[model samples]
Target: MKKLILTVLLSLSGVVAATAQPMCCYNPVLNCIATRTSVRQYAPTAIPDSVTTTLLQAAMCAPSAVNKQPWEFITVTNPEVRNAIKQAIPNSHAAKAPLCIVVCGDMNQALEGQARDFWVQDCSAATQNILLAAHSMGLGGVWCGVYPNTDRCEALCKVLKIPANVIPLNVVCLGYPDPNAPAPTPKDKFKPAKIHVNAW
Candidate 1:
């Protein structure tokens, strides 16, 4: 009789323990892994300011070299600036989204031999944070490369009046998703001939 009573108590205790704790925030890390997709076509509706704030906060949390945090974000939401950004990215389809984030890296903080230009990696991490945060917030977005193309960079510089120290890294087009687009599947993990184990 005592054994059965103890088992019931243990079971009840387990249930109470499980129900006692409140649910936590949506797992940002898991959201980052599962729910990310490049969303080019956005719905006409504008994203809420609170959602945008969460995304920017995520970007700010990204790791930086020596804590320099050499990244700057320029948001273009005005219709005119959005139109100008659409024109700037020759490869992108018409950016009809309500907002775009220009991720820029400061060249002045690129220390010698320390992670081979932290600007690129640091900015990339920030961009990834923005992407993940957007996904978590139920917003659609896509990252468009911009820096390498000198013509595009120059054009944006002139348009946005960016200083010389700040170099454009990428542009993120963000807004509500237009429709149910299929998520991209993971690429094959098979290694190629170039991938050598131990030694080349």
Candidate 2:
């Protein structure tokens, strides 16, 4: 009887250790997600085409509604074009970054009729993947909103000469962060009060 009790305790301890191991380990994915912060100021250094391609690949890997994959990405490196975009959307500081990715949702690629509304959610997930991938690659980025605001959306379309079927969702400014920039504080947003057991 004592031998069986000892065996059970050993197994329980093993389970506890297994559960605690992840909290103490160096998890790169979790680190990337935790350290990702919106960096507005950037260095003059330009991001290479290879890195940009990798980021876009990461974006495209995001899940879509019914696999429609209605997202489109446009990388802008031209100062003139960036300046024009900044002028159109005055709140955006995208001109400062060496690279600006305009994330769009192609309405023509969406499902027919009312079901097409899922494109916005699909594009949002893609945008988040781009930001996370940029952070993982040691680059900083900022997401500047564009869609849901008719005026801002129209301004971007006019300046970039975007096709009517494609709508700009947001601009993700990407670059090497300025060395003098301050570090971001960790945001512990987990709230026990917000959680419900089984049902709300």
Candidate 3:
């Protein structure tokens, strides 16, 4: 009877130990953020429509300036359109991605007066959200700049037939990462010198 009681106590102790383990020991958000690296190379697999919708939902959830959400998204999956975009920006490797999302800002939707200038910032936030969401979903993505460059912007606008009021900010190239490709090393970017106590 004592041996059986000892076995029961041991089992209870094991259960207690297991239950004592912290649930937050593995933080998915932090893991996702840390593991997120710009992926220029991708596999040939296609992204599903459900995943695309989730990514767009994540992008749209970003905060805007003065509640003026002026961002728009255009998903380009067609080979012809992707080729044209590639031709427009010869330096960008995003054309090779399985899916490309064009993030845009609408001038008409911007707040009036000086606040209108904040549309770029709002759109940029949305773009970042999309990239983070893609990474969290185990997909890879890279942000290819477009808005500031007049030539590149004009070329994309012409190719995509974008409207006058809407400005393409950037293109997010997304896909499953190529397994053969080398993973980028995560760097320690924290700098104590960059921090200021009160004023510089």
Candidate 4:
């Protein structure tokens, strides 16, 4: 009985205690994670410098492999440059956003040997952190891929003059949500069937 009570107390404190039943809590961080969604349409209003700084700080807080911290960022506000990048990837939301943060993986800072590609994972985690930070601040963002598509990465590097040691992983398009744009409901992504306990 004491153990069950302790479990209930932990759940209320936003800690995930082992249980098959649905747990309840009011953690703001968890709420931010759960509610965050891609905002493809953005208003023309510019994001303030202070806000941009905060977003970047949040990105840098992401976990990295062996503390490699291999991420680098390029901020774009110029319309001509934005348009040039748009021509490279037609589906990118950056052209419409007031701020486009190009997240890159710095190979120079990456792990060696079989873990060489861990920079990609590190930068991806950073990108997600940026998006969540934006959402928590009432702004919105979308992730647009760049690497693996060699042609797109090359075009982006040419426009931005990216270093040879850095590879553009993705561009995070950010701005205030367009008031006229329809609000999207957060998707129900939790699937009990997908959860494999103990082993596969």
Model 4, position 166: C-alpha lDDT score: 90
Candidate 3 lDDT by residue in tens digits, 80-132: 78988889877666667889999999999998887887999999999888989
TM-score of 2: 0.86
Off by over 4 Å in 1: 1-28, 112-116, 180-200
Clashing pairs in 4: none
In model 2, state the lDDT of residue 153: 95
Choose the strongest candidate by TM-score: 4
Best-to-worst ranking by TM-score: 4, 2, 3, 1
State residue 132's C-alpha deviation in candidate 4, in Å. Answer: 0.3
Question: What is residue 93's positional error in candidate 1, in angstroms?
Answer: 4.7
TM-scores of the candidates in the order shown? 0.74, 0.86, 0.84, 0.87
Candidate 4's TM-score reads: 0.87
Give the poorly placed runs of model 4, Cα more than 4 Å off. 1-25
Candidate 4, 178: how far from true, in Å? 0.3
